[model samples]
Target: MIKKAVIPAAGFGTRFLPATKAVPKEMLPIVDKPNLQYIIEEAINSGIEDIIIVTGRNKKAMEDHFDRSVELELLLEKTNKHELLNTVEQISNLVDIHYVRQKEPLGLGHAILCTKKFIGNEPFAVLLPDDIIDNEEPALKQMVNHYNDVQSSILGVKEVPHNDVDKYGIVEIEKSSTSLYPIKGVVEKPAVDVAPSNLAIVGRYILTPEIFDKLENVKPDAKGEIQLTDAIESLRFDQSIYACALEGTRYDVGDKFGFLQATFDFAMKREELHEPLKKYLKEKLEE
Candidate 1:
């Protein structure tokens, strides 16, 4: 069983600029909750009992966000804000969450490698906070279910426009009729014409303990950062790795436009904001 999950959030989100200068990108708010919280909730919903968040310097805020805040709780209690108090308490007691410092912003692969000691010798799931997937069946849960059936590594994949193939790690898959495709290999940000397939790897993965060895052996790319895709490609040579087409609407909250879209979409779902937000948008569009 995949009881442990890792969230590699050590990256300095330079894309978000001044806002991210002092704040970890993972801690950025989506609606009322931090982006990382959604990913953690998804893991818990997927049956993961423990989570190790790989963090870095200046990421203390992320840790504090999950930790208890007695002062704030007392304030909320004193104000009789029971709803807000319960929400705060629930976040602190969500799951058995732990943290490990990545020490440097080497790369996603390196961040994940830092969690080896906590993972020990077991299969685990990796979820990227950037990809906030909204679905009836949580994206991570779908991957977890697939992992249980195959007993092998699973990569959450989604088809992308051919023109955008260069934006993602494209997977080469053997022809399959089902949503699950047998991954032949993975190419990181290949040119559109050269991309093996339109299926791009998103932020979710269920990998075996053997991947740690592959990650350690992977040479850094030209940027001197180890890439998880490169390690996964190498691991594919040793074991079967399948890409499961995740059924969901994925919002790439790491990008500016995507973040806005997620914010708007999430706002539209809230009962208090739905009609007013819709009316506002409709009026703006008619302007």
Candidate 2:
């Protein structure tokens, strides 16, 4: 069973700029909760017992958010804010979370490699907090279910516009009728004309321990950073990898526009904000 998950949040969040100068991008708020919280909740709901978060400098806030704030809790208790207190306590008790420093801002593949010790010899899940998936079933859970059936590594994939294939790790697949595709290989940010398929690998992954070996041997690209897609493709030569087309809406919250869309969508789902927010948007559109 995949009981452990890794979250590689050591990035500099250069895109978010000045706002991210002091704050970890993963700690940026989406609605009332930090973005990383949503990912952790998904992991916990998906039966993940332990999580190793790969962090870098200025990411201490992310760590503190999950840790217990005793003085704050006591103040909340004294103020008789029972509901707020419960929420705070729940965040702290969510799961068994561990942290490992990546030290340098390598790349996604290197960040994940930092968690090898925590993962030991078992299969594990890797979730990128940038992609917030909204679905009836948690995205990682869906991948886990597929992993159970196939007993192989799984990558959460979704079809993207052919023009957008260059923006993602495109997978070459053996055609199949079901949502699951038998992955032939994966190319990282291939050119539009050269992309094998429009099936783009998303942030959720169920990877085997064997991947660690592949990652270790993967030569850095011209950019001097290891790409996880390269490691996964190398692993494919040894064992099969399958891509499961996840059922849900994926918000690339790492992007500015995508983050705004997620914020608006999540706000519209809240009972207190739904009606008024809907009315306000309608009026703005009519203008």
Candidate 3:
């Protein structure tokens, strides 16, 4: 029962630039709701009860978004805005969310290490909120189901084009099934000539606590940042780690193009926005 999940939201979104100067990237809204909220909802839907969000400076907005506001609720009630009120109220009650500040700008592995006190000896899921996954089955839930059967760490993997393999952490897999692969090796952003496979590691992960020990032994790179990929690779020495191919569309919302694509896809799915957005896209295409 992997009841706890950790979300690393501390990164400085230099990719988004000026807009992210003050606002945390996780707070960036997808349509009307913040991206982090969607990630939280995904966790809740996957039966995750305890959520530990690893945040950094100027991340109060992320915290506030999940907190209850009595005045706002009362005002909504007075205005008879039941729908809006329910939406606002539901955010606070979705799950047991806890926040921990990552005082410095460390790497993904460090941010996850911060949750050791909370996670304490439990196998936990790590959801990078930026990788918004849309599927008939929530991505994390699918990973969890697979985790139950394998009882090993699972990494969400998706097939990328051979040309794009250099842009991602490519996995060297041995025995491969239709939806799962036994990860024999992992290289972070390898050159095309050296890429062992086109299976790229994505954001979602179900990690065992032994990873903490591996992370502690990991040396920081030239940028003075620890790489989670390195730690996971080190853990491979002790146990079997698998790459579970996701049965869904994954949008790397941290990237500008990916964000726009996700917004358009999600919007098109809405009944009210479908026709209007489709008409607007057709009009723009004509120009």
Candidate 2 structure quality by residue, lDDT tens digits, 211-245: 99999999999988989999999999999899999
Which residue pairs clash within candidate 2?
none
Q: lDDT per prediction?
A: 0.93, 0.94, 0.91
Q: In model 2, which runs have C-alpha deviations exceeding 4 angstroms? A: none
RMSD of 3: 1.0
Q: Report the lDDT of model 1 for residue 156.
A: 95
Candidate 3: C-alpha lDDT: 0.91
Off by over 4 Å in 3: none
Query: What clash count goes with each model?
Result: 0, 0, 0
Error at 283, model 1, angstroms:
2.3
Instruction: Write one digit per residue (lDDT tens) for candidate 1, span 1-287.
Output: 99999998888899998999999999899888899998999999999999999988899998899899999999999999999999999999999999999987788899999999999999999999999999989998998888888899999999999999999999999988888889998999999999999999899999999999999999999988989999999999899999999999999999999999999999999999999999998999999
Cα deviation at 118, candidate 2, in Å, is: 0.9
